[model samples]
Target: MTLFVAGLSHKNAPVELREQLAVEEDKLRELLSDVSATGAVRETLILSTCNRVEVYGVAEAPGEARAVVFRHLCRYRGVAYGSVEPLLYTHLDGDAVHHAFRVAASLDSMMIGEPQILGQVKDAFGLAQACATVGPALHTLFTAAFAVAKKVRTETEIARHAVSVSFAAVELARKIFAGLGGKAVLLVGAGKMGELAARHLVEHGAFPVYVANRTWPRAQEMARALSGAAVPFAELETALAGVDIVITSTGATEPIVTLAMVQRVMHGRRARPLFFIDIAVPRDVEGSVNTLADVYCYNVDDLKQVVEANIRERLREAQRGEALVMREVAKFLTRQSDVEVIPTIVSLRERLEEIRVGEVRKALARLPGATAETREAIEALSAAIVNKILHAPITKLRESSRAGSSRSWLPLIHELFGLGRK
Candidate 1:
C-alpha cells in the first residue's frame, strides 16, 4: 500500500475556504466514515484545523485515493472542486511522511514554532483512533510524527521567543523586572490588545493589578474579569504613581500619558523604575517619555520590532528543526519499506519450505527400507539447499527496500513466486 496526504493550508487557501472545510470535533467520526465509504484507502486520518484541513491515508492506488479525497472534501464542505483544486497539495509515500513530521513539529504552521499545531494534530489522531479508522500504517506514522515533534522541541530553540505583540510586551517586562512575581501592573485601556497583554502579565504572576480607562464602566468590567481593582478615570495620574508596569491602548487622538505627567509621578517615587507598553495606533504615550532616567516606554511599533526579531530567531532555529525532520523522515521511510516487503519475504519462505517438505515426504515413501539416519541426512541436505538458494533473493529484497526501490521489483517478485500481494 502507498501512503499519501491531501490538503490545503494557510499557505495556499484563504481563511474563508479553510472555514468551509473546517470540521467540528464532534463530527470527526462522521467525516472519517465518509472517507472510508469511498473505498479508496485502507486506513485514514483527518486533521481539520482553522489553518488547514488534511487527509492522511494508506491506499493500494495513491492517485485514485488523492482524487477521491479531494472530491470528498469538496462535497463534505459543499465547495466547488474547481475552486479548491488549485489550492490543494498532495504528498505521496516518503514525501507524505516528511509532511506529517513537519506539520507535527509546527514547521508548516502559519506561525512556525507555535505549540498549538502539535496538540491539534494529536487531537486528530486521537479522534481517528476512537473511530477505529486508524490502522497499522496510520498508527505508526502518527506515533512517530509525535516523537519527532517532541525531539524537535527539546533539541531546538524554535519556541523559545515570543512572536506576538502582546507576548513580546510581557517578555520585555520579564527582562526589566527579572521576574513578574509581585510586580504591580496598571492597564490604562479596555482595548482587546491591552487586555491580552494584561492577561499575560497576570498569568506570569503580576499582582495588585489595576484597570484605568476613560470610561468607568469598562474599567470596572475589565478589572472584574482580571480579578483586579478598577481605578476611576480621575485617579489615572495617581494610579500611574503606584504601578511598576503600565500597558496603555486607548482610542485617544493625542498623547494621554505625557512626559510631564510621568515626570511628576516619578518625582515622589524615590527613583523607582517604571515601564510603559503603548499598543495603540495613534500613540497613547508620548514618544519623549522614554528619555526619563528610570522610565522605559515601548509603542506598538517597538513591540512589533521585538516580535520581528524573535520571529527571525525562530526561523533560524527552524532550519535546525527542518534538518532534524528530514533525518527522521528518512528513517521512517526505511521502516515503512521494510514493513511493506516483510510479508512477501515471509510468504516466499513458507512457500519454499512447504514444497521442500512435500518432496522429502514423497522421497521417503518411495524408499520404504530407508534408515532413520538416511532420512535425517536427506532432510538436513534439502533444508541447507533451500536456505542457500533463498539467501541471495532475501538479501536483495532487503537492500532494495533500504534503497527505496522496492516498488520497482516487488510486484515482479510476487508474480514470479506466485506469492501474496506486495
Candidate 2:
C-alpha cells in the first residue's frame, strides 16, 4: 500500500470551513472506523483540530482513498460535495510522508512551532489504534512522525517562543502580573484549549485553580485531574473575585461574561488587577471588558497577532526545522521503499536455492555408489556453496535499498539475475 494524505488546513481553508469539518472527540472513533471500512484504505488516522482536519492513510489506490475521505468529510460537514472539493488538497507517497513530518514538527500549523499539534496528532493516533483502523503501515508512519517532531524540537530552535493561543494567553498573563506563582487562576470552561492553558498556568506555579463549567461533573472532573477545586457556574462571580487570572473558552452562542458582570466582580474585589483571556472562538468574555480599569482583556484575535509576531521572529529557526523534517522524510521514505524490496529479495533467493537443489540432484543421480548419506552430504554442500556465493550480493542489495538511488539499481539486479522468467 502507498501512503496518502488529503485534507484542508487553516492555510488552505477559512475558519468557517474548518469549523464545519472539525470532528468532535465523541465522533472520532466511529468516523475513523467508518473511513477505514471503505476498503480503499488499508490503514487510516484522522486528525481534527480547530485549524485543520486531515486524513492520513495507506491505500491500494491513492485516488480511491482521496475520494473516500473527501466524501466522508463532505457528509460530516453537511456541505455540498462540489463546494468542499475546491478547498481540498492531496499528497501521495513521499509527499504524504513529508506532510506528516511537517505537521508533527509544527511547521504546518497556523501558528508555527505551536506544540499543541503534537498532542493532537498523538491523540488521533491513539484513537485510530483503539478503533483498529491503524495497522502496521500507519503505526510506523505515525511513530516516525513523532520521532521527527521530537528531533526537530530538541535539535532546532523552532519552539523557542510560545506561538499558540494558549501559550500566548500565558504570555499575556505574565506581562500583567510579572509572576504567576501564588496567583489564583479561574478557568471558566472545561474545554480542551482552556484546560491546556490552565495546565500551563499551573505548570508556571499558579496556585489553587478554580474550575467552573455548565456541567458540574465535567468541571469537577477537570478540577480533580488538575489538582484544583470545582466551583459551580452560579458562583462564577465569587470565583472571579478571588482569582488573579480568568480564562474563558466556553461554546456559548452569546457572551457568558458580560461587562456589567465583570464590573460588579471588580467592585467586590476592591479593583484588584484581573487578567481575562478569552480564547473561545465565539468569545466568552464581552469585548467591552477591556474598558474597565485594572482589567487586562485579551481575545482570540489578540492572541493570533501574538502568535503571528512570534512566528516571524522564529522564521530562521523554522528554516532549520524544515531542513530537519526533510531529512527525516527522506529517511522514512527510504525505509518504506526497503519494505517493498525485501519480498523481491526473498523471492530471488528462493529461486536461486531451487536451481541449486535441482542441479545437485541431477549430478548426484549419475554418480555410482552414491549412498543416501553421501547424496545428502552433496546436497548440503551445494546449498552451502550457493549461500556463500550469494551472501555478499544479497547484503549489498539490502544496503543499497536504503540509499536514495536504490531505484536505479533495482532493474540492474533484475537484469543480471534473469529471475523473472519461468
Find the candidate with the highest TM-score and give its number. 1
> Judged by lDDT against the true structure, how good is candidate 2?
0.86
What is the TM-score of each predicted model, taking all chains together? 0.78, 0.58
Residues 1-422 of candidate 2 have per-residue lDDT tens digits of: 67889888999898998888888877887777778777888889899999988899888898788778778877877888787778888898789989999999999987677789999999999988889999898898889999999999898878876777898888778888879999999998899989999999999999989999999999999999899999999988878889999989999889888899999989977878999988887999999989999998889899899978777777888899998888888878778878866766887788798999789879987897899899889988998898898887777777787764557666777778877842
lDDT for each of the candidates?
0.91, 0.86
Best candidate (score: lDDT): 1
Model 2 spans > 4 angstroms off = 163-310, 346-388, 391-422
lDDT of 1 by residue, 319-422 (tens): 99999999999888878788878988898899999999999999999999999999999999999999999898888898898998877778878888888655
Per-candidate RMSD vs. true structure?
5.6, 10.3
For candidate 1, give the lDDT of residue 416: 88
Residue-level lDDT for 286 in candidate 2: 93
